[model samples]
Target chain A: MLLYCKDLTKKFGEITAVNRLSFDVKAQEIFGIAGPNGAGKTTLYNLITGVYKGIGEINFDGSEINNLDPHRICHKGIARTFQIPQLATSLSAYHNIKIAAHFGNEKNRVDKKVIDDVIAFNGLRDKQGIVADKLSLIDKKLTMVAAAMATQPKMLMFDEPMAGLSPLEIRHLMDLFKKINEERGLTIVIIEHFMKVLTELADRLMILENGAKLCIGPPLEVTQDKRVIESYLGNCYAESK
Target chain B: MGHGGNLMKIKKDLGVLLAVYGLLALLPIFFHNNMSLMNILIISLIWAVVAGSWDLIMGFAGIFTFGQIAFLVIGGYSSVIFCKLFGISPWFGFLIGGIVAGGAGILVGLPCLKLKGAYVALVTFAVHMILEPFLKSDIGRAIGTGGAQGILTVPPLKIGSYVYNAMEPTPWFYTLLIISFIAFFIIYKVVHSMWGYSFIALRDSELFAQSVGVNAFKYKLIVFGISAALTGMIGGVYANYVGMLSTRILGLDLFLILMVMLVLGGMGRFPGALLGAFITMFISESLRYFDTYRLIIFGLLVMVLVIKMPQGIIGLIFPLGKAGIIERTILHFREKKAKKAEMIT
Candidate 1:
């Protein structure tokens, strides 16, 4: 396993955001996580990326990496994209990617070639000169993805990468995710709301309810689980099929 | 977009910097006989460094600090003290003063790391507020701050046998010109480097910057120190040029005047603060005939300008693309001439 979370738990005042969630992600696998609002999917990503300090241990690539700073976690070969695209709005797309390539790694020297390749890989070549604030929503999301990739991470996490995307853009992004996994041999853990996208793209899926695991298995079997259907998928989803 | 494009931008920016400074350098050749004008020019150069440093941290780095004048005061006091007690040359005192102020900046920046927005501003401003009392207390007197009277006998900067003093404005003017030019050049380089990118990233969103592996706290603290050091060094120079220091230098009036420079220069724009400093000094000096009403008129002018040209003089002169006021006016006239020629034809 490239990522091993053992009984991770986080609480905020009266509410527990993530409760004793244990999961393992194999290297180079596309792992999918689906949960309703307040289900702690993003909170889990935060815990792993060290945006928040949570109880229990998170081991990545054989080293314990719980409660580290976000930058240090990034330097340890993990990068993530936000639910809302966060970018230096006044800067060009190329400059945005250059920031990650310059600081994300441990090396003192930054390779311009790597930044350019990531920009091209994400198909942001034409839009590279345009400032981020002027880019379309899809292009902004692509710029964020390109920045994350430029970090040269072994594992990448996506928080609702398809939230505002149209069906055609969603398809394009899904293909991009698959290419990133297959061509780059990088582990991906995606938190998404679209069950169809998860079923089609993810090798395995984990469903959470109220910050606790509902079920975990292959996407086909987990979608068939009764608990996932009742609490998450709901009767409407079950009946639609 | 690419290395080539970035290189071209750097070259163009450097060209502008050279043009501006070159014009200013030639001023002494014409106005060397006018001692009052030369004094105004020298003072403007000093404030230019202070205002530019403030812009670096506040505008570019997105740190809303009100302690810039406080840093200048610390540098002034420290340099004078070092020169008096330790018997060091005023030249060496400038370096010492910068080191001390930079240290103070880091010390203050530590508590500010966890703070956001107004809280950071409040904490830094508190430093500014507390400085007056500290310099007036017994500890200040014991440390040769001269108590409430302030430092009276600041040593003049000397080069071998030649001394730089107020009576001879020529040497002081040229000396400060070189110093201010170097200071602005450093700021320009920083604004165009990786450090500049990181600052903009953190300023926009600290969370995103951290996710991308930029340590926000480290960068903020470093910028605070750098800005303070530059301001402090210039403060030392100002002390020697004026040949004295006092708590009056910590007055709110001067603080607000410095702020007007930033506001009129277009915050976050490099070399804008430089232009703002010179223009503000000229206007303030020109209004000296109005007596006490000068400040009121100055304040009113700043308000009107701020409302009318929110981007300041530089923004008015060279906005993004070719739509600046001057450009538009020129284009309008050209179009009128073209129509007139067509009618004649």
Candidate 2:
């Protein structure tokens, strides 16, 4: 396993956001996580990335990372994109990418080649000079992805990468993800809502309901499972099929 | 085309910055032996150095410290006490003062590392105010702080035979001008470096910065150390220049003046700190003729400026919203002309 989480749980006052969740992601696999709103998919990502403290054992590339700081976790080679596109708004896209490149390097150096390659790969070459806040939503998302990729992580997580994108934009991102996975052999974890996206892209799928695991299996098997269908993949999804 | 224009704009801005600094460096030549004017200039330069430091931590790094003046106080006392009791040269005292102040900065920054926004500001203000009473105690007096009466007969900078005394403020002015220039330049370099980019990134979004591997507490401490060190050095120089160190410096008035100057000149810009310092000093000195009314008038002025021109004087002059005023102006005209030519074609 490239990444492993065993018995991870997060609680907020009276509510448990993630409860006894355990999963193992093999190397170079595109793992999809799906659930209804408030199912703690993002909370799980937070726990894995050390953004939130949770009762868990998180091992990334054979190292314990549950107690590591977010930056240290990033240095340990895990990078992620936010659902809302957290970017340095006033700075140019190139500068935003450059900051990440300098910081994420184990040698503490900025690699110009990596910055340019990431920008070009993400199709932000033309908008590289534009400030992130000024870029369109698609471009902002691209910039965020480019920034995450600049960290040179062994594993990358996307939090709803298709949330607000157009159909064409979603297709473009899917292609980019496939390209990245195939070309670089980096493990990918995607938290998404679109059933079709998950079925098409992910090698294995994990479904959650109210922060507890509902099912974990092949994408098709998990989607067709009775509990997943009843709670998340509603009758509409089954009828569309 | 846009990339080419941005490169041109950056080059133009650099040239303009050099020109501005060059002009300021020539101030001694014009003022010559006008001791009173030179005294004002010296004090203004000191404030500029200190305020510029504040700008780096508070404005750029988003630390929002209100107790920056405390570093100056610590620095001034360290130098003056060392000069008086230990017979150290004022020149060496300057270096010691910076180190001492930087140490104090680390102490102050540790508690502040976990704080954010107004809480940081309030805590810093508390630290700034807390030191005054401690210094006024009998132990503080015995330690050469001179209690509430302040330290007297602090020796001026002496090299071989020459003493930069108040009788001739020319040497003092030149010394302060150079020191202030160095402080500004160092800060400029820091804000422009990769570290500076991380500062801005953290300022904008701490989560984003952390996710990308920019350690928040680490960078904040570095900025605080640099800022406090610079300000402390200025304080040490100011003590020698005036030949006095006082508890009066711990007052809210001095700290407010620093904030007003920073806000009025625009925070986050080095030139803004420079302009704010020089202009505020000039206005305060000119209004010193009014005696007691001087402070009230200054307060009103700050209020009006804060309300009317929150971007400060730098914002008004450099409406382009970038760093270099002169270069931004040139770029503005060049772009306009380019657009006009395009229309004609």
Best by lDDT: 1
lDDT of 2 by residue, A1-241 (tens): 9999999999999999999998899999999999999999999999999899999899999999988989999999999999998987767888889889999876789888998899889988788888778789999889988999999999999999998999999999999999989998989999999988889999999999889999998998998898998999898888788
lDDT of each: 0.90, 0.86
Q: After superposition, which runs of candidate 2 have C-alpha atoms over 4 Å from their true positions?
A: B1-16, B289-308, B320-345
* Local lDDT at B209 for model 2: 90
What DockQ do the predictions score, one after another?
Answer: 0.61, 0.61
Please state the error at residue B255 of candidate 1 in Å. Answer: 1.1
Q: After superposition, how far is residue A208 of candidate 1 from its true place, in Å?
A: 1.6
Prediction 2 TM-score vs. true: 0.93
For model 1 chain A, where is the 10-residue window of minimal lDDT?
Answer: A105-114
What TM-score, to 2 decimals, does candidate 1 have? 0.95
- Writing each residue's lDDT as its tens digit, candidate 2 over B82-180 gives 877788888889988899999999889999988889999999889888889878899899888988888877876876798767787777777776788
Interface RMSD, model 2, angstroms: 2.0
